[model samples]
Target: MGLLRKAARAMLSLSLATRPAVADTEIDKHSVDVAATARAFAQAAPLAIGDSYDYAPGVQGEADAEGRIGDTDFKLRLFGAWDAQDEERRYADIRQASLHWRHDRLSLGAGVGTFFWGVSESINVVNVLNQADLRQAVDSKEKMGQTFVSLGLRFGNGELSLFYLPTFREREFPERPAFGLPVSQRALFETPDKGGDIALRGLFYAGDLEAGLGYFKGTRRSPLLIRRSPTATEWTPFYIETENLLLDALYLLHEATLKLEAKTGRELDQGFFAANVGIEYPVYSLPGGIQELSLIAEYLVDDRGERAETLGQNDLFIGLRTSFGDIGNSSFRGVVSYDFDSQGNYLDLGLEHRLSDYFRFETRALVFLNAGRDDNWLYPVRNEDFIEFKLHYSF
Candidate 1:
């Protein structure tokens, strides 16, 4: 009967067989429609047991490649000029071939392929060095497998899970990447089972909160930190990770992470912790039904001064998400973050577009600006720029 109500019905007419009516003064039909759409989406989305891949091969023209290593043999501008002439490119092989299968109570997944791993990083320093860059110095392709066996207990509100990771390969530790490693070590990039290793991730959940703890005791040396200073070039850090997350739709959520590692040479023990808490609100609509808004603020601490002294002093990132119209998942989101007392200041802008039930594409650009001269900047003094582009697909 009203103009706005008619608009919502018009939009729903395209998909729903009948426009569900709402109690004029009790609840909004739009909220009902939104909730219905969410349920439909959750039911139609691709299952966890599926195969997919991504190729994020790009270039980093000039990244202070010659700053501390060999400044004389190569002038700073030479690397910059080389970048201008021919930048470095990477072929991630996002994934190789993989298979998935899921039943009412159990699910399994395995693959021998290309995948991008979020190497355990010191959260304090947001740009200490990318995990890809770290692994690039050792191994290229990492074989990955995961299994989820859940049993609905506690009146269908609680579940349990188990995960596994096998020993893959090591990175090509070039004497000095300035030159490059020999063909022998580079060949190890694709090797599998050359060593023995196993990792376990156990999770327990109920209602809106969950707790998880994991351990990795492997022989393969995949140290997340490698220090190469003139005074002491040490290879310390084997592997370690500790993390947890709590998620809720209508109330509140909290997430936290802490990592510890012991290296081969220095035998240094390093770690850091990050925690965040947020609020959520559920809203019903005038046309369909369920809609919601969420806000979160995160804080991180890095105590890896023994390894990468320039890792992180402190870090914070906040995000806001909203859903509307006939959309199923979140239709739009915006984020703001402040980090790096070293390289000056950094900001990120991102956008996500859903193509279908099995595919999605997203692009984000980060800009770095030197806030001031030397001592004033909390980060390193590198006039470098970083940009990341990615696409996700589930079969």
Candidate 2:
């Protein structure tokens, strides 16, 4: 880790000396857009046997604006969602508000933004720049914007990026009464008090292969839960009403990618290593005009062993995607992830079809299989299988 830090500093110093001059040419443009969605969700199983079925209705609105002014670019995005069944699920957030400046091979950015890194299908162990927005989804596919200042330098066949994150963001969670973990199990979150975080990443492209290496030193976005009350009783198989659980932890991450991906992180007290290797291939034009079918497979492994909580220790993810290259630009995707250690599995299916230039229809379903007590992450929400339908309109 010390060597990594020294290397990052050296790269930064070298890049600073080679900063390119800004161009005098001016190109300014700006546009604003808004989107709204109405969604409905239905649970596949009762929270309790004989209990009433759970249903939820939700609506979301998003506003976005972006433009370029000379050598600088700016973007802003805001989102709000309302859920009738879950108060915790109803929230508003500033997804992005950032400005970027580029001069030849050098680029710099600041403000709140979101970044996705890594090449894994089911999990993103190497992508930690933003906090997970669990209020929207438990799959970790959604991310909250993070405030940071970043600098990037492009040289040779690679680019190096340095980030100084000045603020820490915590992961959002579903309300205590939600189908997932109970409120009592909620961790007591504390904001970090000292200097924030620092991260560095280098990405290189060679032939048809792309690779990246990343390092992060600072607070962990995901908190670790510590039982506060030892005598709390379980009210249901899925819900436990414990008084308060302390959730605080920090860690360092070292990740590398080679067409495939690998990651390792160390908490203040413990550490774990993880990896994912996958391939994606597409078959063009089946009977339909300009249609394509894509196949994907990724194997995941984590060395946290039985103690792993959020991530599956060992799993395989297989996915298929179909693109109907018609006027509507419709698509369908399905993924099945199986945990080798616990023999538990889940399937995710999604379909999206553009009805017109201004409207679209989408639906998603998550189904769990054999997610029993032996399962690490899925055991808590074993019965919360659900399907959601949504209609979105943009203007």
**What's the lDDT for all of these models?**
0.31, 0.64
Tens digits of per-residue lDDT for model 1, 1-395: 23223323332342132222332222111110000000001111111112111122322222111111111111111111111111231222212222223346554433222222221222221111112332122112223211111122222544443333332333433221221111122222212333333333334455654443333333323344333344432433333332222121122234332222112112233233332323333333434632555454544433343233222334455665555445654354554545544334445455566667755555544344444443222322122223334444433
Highest TM-score scorer: 2
lDDT of 2 by residue, 1-395 (tens): 33224333433443344442345333343333443443344443334322334676778878877765444666777788887756666887767776677788989877677888876667766777777887766687888877777899999998999988776655555642233334343345433252267888888766555677788876666555444556543222121111111111111122222236666666545666767776666665377644777787878887866544345778888998887856528899999988888889888899998888778888888777668687767776666567777788777
Error of 1 at 202 (Å): 2.2
Model 2 score (lDDT): 0.64
Error of 2 at 338 (Å): 1.1
| Clash total of candidate 2 | 0
Q: Which stretches of candidate 2 lie over 4 Å from their true place?
A: 1-53, 176-181, 184-195, 233-259, 306-311
